[model samples]
Target: MTQNQTHDPSGLSQEQAKVELLQLQAQLIAADQAYHQDDTPILSDADYDAAKRRYQALVTAFPRLQEIATQLDTVGAPVGSGFGKIQHVVPMLSLGNAFDDGDVADFDRSIRSYLGLDANQPLAYTAEPKIDGLSLSLRYEKGVLIQAATRGDGATGENVTANARTIADIPQQLQGAPEVLEVRGEVYMSHEDFAALNARYMERGGKTFANPRNAAAGSLRQLDAEITRERPLRFFAYSWGDLSAPLGNTQSEAIERLHELGFQTNPLTQSCASVAEMIAHYRHIEAQRATLGYDIDGVVYKVDALALQARLGFRSTTPRWAIAHKFPAELAWTHLEAIDIQVGRTGALSPVARLTPVTVGGVVVSNATLHNEDYIRGRDNKGEEIRDGKDIRVGDWVQIYRAGDVIPKVADVDLTKRTGEDVPFDFPETCPECGSPAVREEGDAVRRCTGGIICPAQAIEKLKHFVSRKAFDIEGLGAKQLEMFYGDPDLPIRTPVDIYTLEERDAGQLAKLKNRSGWGDQSAANLFAAITEKRNIALGRMIFALGIRHVGEVAAKDLALHFGSWDELAKALDLARPAALAHRSADMAEDQERAEANREGRRAKIKETREAVLSRLELHLAAREAWEDLVGIDGIGATVGLSLSDALANAQERAVFDDLVGHLNISAPAAPTQESPVAGLTVVFTGKLEKMTRDEAKARAEALGAKVSGSVSKKTDILVAGPGAGSKEKKAQDLGIRILDEDGWLAEIAPK
Candidate 1:
């Protein structure tokens, strides 16, 4: 770790070090194919950089390490058999990164200061998000793409023409007829696709991807271009490497031209009139970045005027006219005032750390998730929760981090900051919200409250779930509005049904509720009206509204489509319950027999018998006939059915559901559309798309007749592969389904 004498760990002598450096250079040249040129990262950035740095250092320390030029200075031809190699007309280079906003601002100031321009000069700048993905240089001759190469080094890159052509957004031919052009952009994965892919990977007993950038790299570099075509890879042009003539005089104009030429550009990109405006734009993007569909490491600011850019050109590793204003990695240190327990809908207790308000990644943070009780308390010598050492006691300082720049999580606690007065924290034995005894399941971490429907927190969460976008989608009946409706002293609306019958309530009480100081009658009426409009919910939305565990929007839709009708689904579920009960009875009978056979005498048998009795009593109360029937539904998985049945069958939950259903209709389904492109056949889309956005394509296909499934299955009839399609395409190919490119897909659905 120290500043060393011969820091090389390989322990090669000077002569040997020179040969090793040359070998490393060659290896690195080839490794670029696996990294940038391909989707698979042969090594992590840190590992790759360390090797490159070591080689560079060796070459500097002993000049003999600089061996023969291995054509590393020139962009290598594409290696994959499916794609033909095309030499880059101009060199593609990588930009040096500035870690913080200060560094970027300094770069900007230096550029301006070097030019010796007065403050009065009309200095315009264009800012765009810096996508963390492979950098590609796309060249077009007579408006059509002739080549595509990676930014291997400053001078050259590996040819990836066939792979690049698979990217939907990347134009095969430019519009507006530019004679010669070379555009630079990043290829990336959407957050949704990344999450889906990782989920599939985990489900299939495969390793999860660390990040989307790694996922994109791995997808792009596959030996099969078909695999690359399936990944949800996207491209956004930022700059240019070669041009016969300028597309426009200004940087903004060039971007506009690119957009017009069928290339997807970042919508957030803006042309600012001043440095202050540029900084404002940068901060705006940083603040809203968490909700952005794709990953962006930072904002890149470029001098808008092409003439000025030309005059202020070329640094060793960056353009003098442009600088990236990087957002600091989100971090926060807050006092862990208390850790509260939250019982999930499925009876899992989650530990949440209450914290002093702190700003991180432009959002105010006052709470952090502790994940589990074990995570809250530090581990002991046996790697268990420390009994002697301090647990996450009241008033402890904790470091919180947003991994991949989302979700506030407690990273670590500062034990040193703990006061001696702080006592060892004990998790709550009962639910704080409903005073029910907390129960911990075997092989589970947190203890859950047995309160079920009576819990106020649970009720609130359920309400929020009911009105969620994928459920009822009552626009005005948002969380805040729901809270207002429930908490108002003037109005006694307490259940989901209460929302539908808001207008029918006493006028004086309603007026008092609506005109209660902050919110007006108009807003209250709007909320009620919105809730009323969603009374006839679709089967899928109704299923989601029930707030079943692990039943997300996609799963809900899948169930709805498969079951077709709620009546049929309900009947199926009802029939399945007795079977489940019989199964449970068998389990209980087996347990009794086992206890009788393997008793450590009568005392052990007595204890086991008592526990079994208690368990049966709980199950009898928890799993009613209605609940069993619901769980039996064919499309409803055990996890979801059990949770739903348990919630609804609970006396208090039943009362709430009954009251809500009485006041409003919760069973509306949309009419099926006319015949369309994918009717009666399952389809799964993967990778970066060109012809239409994922949502658009899904909607269009659904409207036409396609049943879009998330995962690849034997039922799938077609696989529309785009650039970076990744695994799904590979799975589809293995399954022998028909494959279609963006154009092919367009042709299939085109008017006859």
Candidate 2:
């Protein structure tokens, strides 16, 4: 959308620019939703800014076109459906951006001209690092923290006051503050915290995020605030939204007042008297970016005078009184030494470009993602030309850039520098790890190997997942030991079952292990003991250890709670497998071209699909209506059910599973210990609880063997009502459901 994109204003007619503007708005909206609401970004900030700039430039050229856009003033995507949304009194405005020195100079000049001041007139502005994290607003009423919301679409936000109260940095009560103050800030995670949290996730076999910004956003957006409480989130107040009374006449003074009230405000903020000082401060912050410990993509400059800021007003999307000086994208040209295909735990064949050593954004990057086959073939998803329409080769020079402190990516290929000996890479058709057929389903972007645990790479990864913290969690066994033994022919820890009998299998090999590098006799025995100790495990842990696709810790626990024991779970899964498979097949056949014929043909197609599913699931229908029952579970969806079906139906996987089960003791999830009368019953809590927070109440209920549900149903055995409870209580009475006031519930759960 920037004039830089097309390089000529005359070449683009007003109508064409309007069309481009419309397209850009749609794209920006989608991108914003993906990044801000979904915690997933389809495009980098660099690309987004370019599109935004183009839109802005188009509107500036065609002033009449401004009337058509409303998103021009939008800050972030509107609050998503995941959380309760709250409206904002003052819109959280986004800042204009300055990508280079010329842009910065122009910004200063534009401001002075708008105020009818001399070009050399001093303009005091507040400069601070622009934290790349979730924007939040904290509202305090009568010097008491009352509400917290996310910067959703600038005008509306998600209420996260409970979660905000959990962060130690955010004071629950503030002193010496305005009666009604809405402090705007960024919710961020430091690099150390981000790394630690990511390590914990990896240890638990949970998905890890790309960067601190993403981690922070994902943490704050959790439906369960307890999940957000567990994350290492911090807040830095830098601005204000709405205030009952003015705290200060200047921006810096207001920020200082916030800091004085026990709020965590950035200490690096400085007052710049001129554009030179602003640019200097920007460079200073840019120089320290590598050591900041948190992610910051740029430096923000705001007009210090509150009155001036108000007078300057705003553009459709950004404040005219403020602009952000973005740091240059770190990129380096390096030789594409080789292209390597790595088989991930999900069996995805990801292409990685091995590059000549190059430092990007202060880190030495030796590899970058090639993305997919389309990227390698010099085309985008829509088959449009890219990488200058030149295919990348091993000997070609490529540009690697680290965008906004995330993973490095090969941005472009230098076709002119490609050596004559360079040849296009031929992607493999079979799994490089196990020789299994690699498949690319229709519409799938990446090819995945059909091999499950048979592939050594997949096996090792799965075994590592089995021993993860959320799975078996063996004391002495870890990823390193698993990989070491997976490579060693003498080791008995090749499979999960092998661990159970390791003490006996390695009795003579103990001394040998002691002699081997990085191992000793005592450590080996400790590992063996640890393995033996985990032989008797809860059903959920056993299920998680199996590494069934989409069967995470939560799903495993859900299944264990429902099925109780190993035999029961195994029987249910076996019966459910066929139904799940057939249902998935029918679901995948989205095209109705076959039904284009007459009524009989249509009926036959429908009957064929239905019969095929029922025929495969005939035995399972008698065994708990397998697929339907599975789909009804809280977390289980059609996709997950299908994955479970695949795992259970495969003969190799089943054999391996049974063999592993034979050596272990799998029990039901532990039953209640008579702590409460309602132990093992489903409980529903409604409204606010004075004695404890919602999280605390839920935790106590779960500890007492009650499944705490969000809503009351026929399955709900107990309904606990607190103050303000209305609908749930009325429903409980109509259903003749047992009801308890908060105090009554507490008394019932008390030790008798």
Candidate 3:
């Protein structure tokens, strides 16, 4: 989309340049959205920027493109409308990014100089990784999540309540929280999940996603619940918006308060006293980005003090209090000698470009994903074949770059450097692992081997996922344990059932197992007990333990809540299988109808299906429901119900499950209702509270079902203001509100 800058040797008219510039601008914006928001980039950043520069030149020359395209205008407006407009309690402003160590140091100097505070004045900041995903706001009233919206225009956003509810880390009901609160954070996919998803996409004849961000956006934006459910998305709370009362006097304290309120805030965030230390933290994260499990475009630095931040706040869009320090993008050049096609866990044959080792950033690169045959030969003037290019050959010497230093990709190629010895990459005709005939589906790009469980890659990854911490959480037995279990002939541990059978291992063989360095009698006993402990697992945990392709913690919880028991859930999934398969088989079928029907009938149909399946399958649906009901409240959704039905539909798996459940004793989730001493009351703390800080006072108030208002109103039931409470004290007196100083406020809430 870049305007042709070649002197227009033909002497093009101004109108032509203007037209080109506008088109280029549109293309650039679309590419940015795809790359940044959606994680799929149609153009490389370099290509996109090149286009932008060309557009900028024409805009500069004609000036008409500027008026028409307004390429330099602010970001796009927020879209969607699920939230009924409620004014943000605190402005949810954007952050200005600082690209390097110098920028961070300069930010520190600016804050220090602006605040007129010394180094010892305690400028506490809470730094967290800037998650590269979609931003959202969750509003809670009376401790329950009422609405969840996207961060559209900093003011209004699209309502995404259903999707938000699907995120497990976000609580449905707040515990020890304010009357009104808004939690903000990003929802993202783990790198491993992104890789898997991309593999699946290519295998299914679907367009391969560019990155995790695009995958997340595409998944979340899908109208179908099933699609969202299938995505491996997670939420990490970085900050908040609005509160009935100030969370903390300082940024560090506010983060702590958020964590205490049962919100899943990142544990890695820290406070730094100086810019030097801040830079250290930023660099450390940059160095460790590859191991962090998710992507972060940069690190965010914010002024520590709430009062100071308020004093020096606001710009047109970004807050003066906060800035993001971005790490430079990592790119590397590697020689492409060969391209290898490997079958994935989902049976997708992915083309990988094997490269001669080249250093990019700090990491050495030897391979890059070709995506598919189309990707291999796709190249523009640049040698790289990505979304913007059309196929690359095996012999091309590809220039590669890492988008965030975490994902290595081919950037371009030095075709002149190509040794003419290379050959065109061939699409695989059979699965490399299982030797099964590979077939590319109608729309799929990569061919897939329908090997299913027979494939080693699929079986291994599935097993690893099955015992993951969030799932079964079998201690002492991790990926290594599972690998050994699968590989060892004598142990022969293959499934969850195999773990139970471990207790019955022959005494003669027991000695051999114990002799293994990491395993001993006690360790083996613990593993068996842990496995046993999960028997009769909570319906939700059981669903998660199964390691279905897309089901996660939150979805599992929703399924449990909706169906109430394992039997009910199993029936629902069974019914969904036909729909999923049918939709998969039909090229023109609209998935939306099936999705909607599944959503509407999720609860009712689950109950009906449970009754029918229980009679036919002879599973104890009533007992399961009773167990679920006794465990406390649960939430169900179409995704979990479908997964459960699909998983249990196999008679063999069901038999294994029956045995697994019989031995497991996972109690239902704890009851939601707990009796707290502080409930249904109004309390306020003013001035210096001696027993605790202002944060502690506010936390206690909110915990006790009392609304904590910032300033006194006539409606204020009790006001705890101390010695220096000035105007707020007078307001309380004028409003005839009960006023309690520090000691008085403490005494009332104090446990004798």
Evaluate residue 436 in candidate 2 and report its C-alpha lDDT on the 0 to 100 scale: 99
Candidate with the greatest lDDT versus the true structure: 2
Candidate 2 residue-wise lDDT at 667? 81
Predicted candidate 2 versus true structure: per-residue lDDT over 450-520, tens digit per residue: 88777888888677767855478787676667887777778646677777767777756766865664677
Residues 651-751 of candidate 3 have per-residue lDDT tens digits of: 76677777877667655444335444444444555666555556556656654545454445444577788767788788778878878777777677676
Clashing residue pairs found in predicted model 2: 1-54, 2-54, 72-316, 72-317, 73-316, 73-317
Error of 2 at 702 (Å): 8.6
Runs in model 2 lying further than 4 Å from the true structure: 1-329, 379-389, 536-538, 588-620, 665-752
Better structure of 1 and 3 per TM-score: 1
Is 1 or 2 the stronger prediction by lDDT? 2
TM-score, model 1 to reference: 0.46
Least well predicted 10-residue stretch by lDDT in candidate 2: 1-10
- Give TM per candidate: 0.46, 0.52, 0.44
10 residues in a row with least lDDT, candidate 1:
1-10
- 10 residues in a row with least lDDT, candidate 3: 1-10
Q: Per-residue lDDT for 239-356 in model 1, tens only?
A: 7877888889999999888888888899999988876777788889989988998877778888889998876655323456775554554567888887776655445566677889
